[model samples]
Target: MIRRRYIDGRYGQVHLRENTPLGEPPLVCLHATAYSSRSFSALLAVLDGKRHVIALDTPGYGESDAPDGRIGIEAYAESIAEVCPDRFELFGYHTGVSIAAEIAIGHAARVDRLTFMGIPHFRALDFAAWRSKLAARHVLGERLDQFEERWRFFVSERAARLPLGRAFENFVDELKAWPHGWWAHDALFEHDLLARLEQVRQPTTVLNPPGHLAEPSRRAAAAMPDATVIELPEMPGPALDLYADTIASLLLAKQFVGGAVPA
Candidate 1:
């Protein structure tokens, strides 16, 4: 069973969802922007007995305390590292990828390896446009119609393949972090991600699912010194929930071959 708890962190309290069946070094997970650790519930369930896993809600999201003001990706990485084990492999999805990369670069001794579901590599102009567009969507006191429009956009474009219930759960997570949902994106676009990826010397795996991020993820992987790309064209929309077993098997196999421990 997955258990939830909180630990003192840089911001105040950091909420964590953990499943620890064995005593091996844990695999720490970080979720995408606006979403919480709950996004990894399905993934954690599949890896329950096979490997110990802990998924954290990035500061300012889920039950974790919000920061005093907007911070950069490095701050996000530091806050997350403050609550992580001294040594462990890391897995990140979307926005979490940026934070994970920063951690691997800044806290090299702590992170053993890295796994990213999507690594966004956008041009300066493109990123700026995207930041502006997303910021507009997240207006604090937007009209109900605007909110509904955003909801419909998420369901149709982002969560099209997700089951109704699962999609709704994700949407609710977005709502819960509505006020600061754009903060991570702001930090992400401002960071020198490609340079940081190049600095990450840890063994890395990039899982590329079919979507807008697929090409960018491939390009980002090319810059990393030690990285492998696993294309998941067949798995679309929320691979954590849809392809949990596959992902779990791959992660276990990697750790076993690396002499970490047998899953």
Candidate 2:
């Protein structure tokens, strides 16, 4: 079974959802912006007996305490790293990809291998446009209808590929992040992820699920020294609940080959 706990971090208490029954180095997971470690709930369950996994709530996003203000990607990486094992594999999704890359680069000795589900490799102009759009759209207002509108948007747009209940779960996670949720995006757009990815020396796997980031993930992979792109054409969304088994299998296969598990 997956379990939850809190650990000391640079920010205060960092929350984690983990399954530690397996006898292997843990797979440290990081989630996308506005979401939390809860995003990996399904995946944690899937890998419960087979692999040790720990998913962290990025500071200010989940049960973790929010930072004093907007911090850079390096800060996010460092804070999360404070709670991670001395050595392990890493997995990241969306904005987590940026943070994971930074962690792998900064803490190279600790991270053995890397896996990324989405890479946000936007051009300078594109990055600015995205920040502008998110800033204008993600404001939390006092009106109740504004909140309803956000809910409807998630149901129809952001989490369309998920079931109604699953979509609602995501929506709730997004709400929990509130005003600081946008901080991750701010740091993401400002980070030179390509440069950081190039500096990552670990073997990396980029899962290319059908999404806006597919092409960009490939572009980002090319910058890395040892990275492979695996296409998941059937996965239209990054809902871990729906694709946990598939994701776990791919990760396990890589781990086995990399000697993360007994051959």
Candidate 3:
């Protein structure tokens, strides 16, 4: 069962959902922007007894307290790291990838392995476009209809499998975290991912699922000193929900028995 808990950390109270098995090195998961640790619901369900799996809500992005100022990726990394075990593995997606990479680089001894999906590779020019979109999404008119409109548009794009009620709840989760959502995007824009990846010493796995983020994962795999790239040619959104088992297999094979070339 996934249990929700709070940790008083440097920033403030950090909320996390976890399924911990006794004596195993924990698998700490970080989520994408606009989403919380709830993004790993499916994965956690499947991984419940397999290992110790902990999914953290990035500060200001879930039930966690917001930082005093707009912080960079390093601060985000520090927040998550403060709540983790002395030795653990990492799973990160999109914005989470930036934070995870920073942690693995700076605290190499604490992380046994690193896994990333939807690794972002953005150039300086992309920030303008991102800022425009962020501005549009940051609609806080204090009108219920406006929130509903935003919720519908978001659900139409990603949560088709979810029922309307559950989807709306998830959308509200996004809305409640809106103030900090754009902060993650800005941090990603400023992050030097290549420089960070070069410093990662743990064994790494990059999931190359077809999407805007796939090519970046490919680039990231090449940059890592010891890394394995898994080619998953499915649409990223649905594939992420359905392929938790596939990822579990990789983690088990690599970290438990023996690592091998992905078949």
Taking the tens digit of each residue's C-alpha lDDT, what string does model 1 give over 1-263? 99999999988899999996587778999998888999899888988888899999999898888899899999999999888888888998988999999999888998899999978676523777776865443567846664686578566566555787777777787887876788888888888888988999999999898987899889889989999999999998778988898898888888777476544
What are the clashing pairs of model 1? none
Q: Show model 3 residue runs off by greater than 4 Å.
A: 124-127, 134-139, 159-166, 257-263
Model 2, range 48-152, lDDT digits (tens) per residue? 888899999999998999899889999999998878888988999988999999899888899999999878887623766777865444666787776776687
lDDT of each: 0.85, 0.85, 0.79
* Model 1, CA-based lDDT: 0.85
Error of 2 at 185 (Å): 0.5
Candidate 3 residue pairs in clash (backbone atoms < 3 Å): none
Angstrom error of the Cα, residue 125, model 2: value is 8.3
Instruction: For residues 54-122, write the lDDT of model 3, one tens digit per residue.
Output: 999899888888888688999999888988999999998989999999999878899999888887775
Which 10-residue window in model 3 sums to the lowest lDDT?
A: 131-140
Poorest 10 consecutive residues by lDDT, candidate 2: 254-263
Choose 1 or 3, whichever is better by lDDT: 1
RMSD of each: 2.3, 2.4, 2.7
Can you rank all candidates by lDDT, best first? 1, 2, 3
